[model samples]
Target: MRKFNLVFYFSGGGQFACEIEAEDMATAGSIAESLELRLSGCKGYDLYVKKEDK
Candidate 1:
């Protein structure tokens, strides 16, 4: 699994961000989308996969 950082932006103001562990980006995006729908005034979200140290 990999670590993903998700940032959700709202139309009404404020933001929601978290770091989650997931198998892949697709799964992370799905989770983020689900959260967005559950929260009111969510405009969209950005997904970032954390880079592992060498």
Candidate 2:
């Protein structure tokens, strides 16, 4: 299994991340769902928070 870094984001604020062993990034989706976390979406690596400024 290869090491994939997954990051989960929240609408309110902040993010969560974990490194797991998986065959591919797509397969890791189930792992994220199994955790039962409130997620806007799985975002890129280190983008922890954001909102529309304009």
Kindly list the per-residue Cα lDDT of model 2 for residues 1-54, writing each as its tens digit. 656666666555668777766565555656656553444454434321222257
TM-score of each model, in listed order: 0.84, 0.49
lDDT of each: 0.89, 0.54
Write the residue-wise lDDT of candidate 1 on 1-54 in tens digits.
999988999887789888999898889889888898998888998999987879
Candidate 2 TM-score, C-alpha based? 0.49
**What TM-score does model 1 achieve against the real structure?**
0.84
What pairs collide in candidate 1? none
Best by TM-score: 1
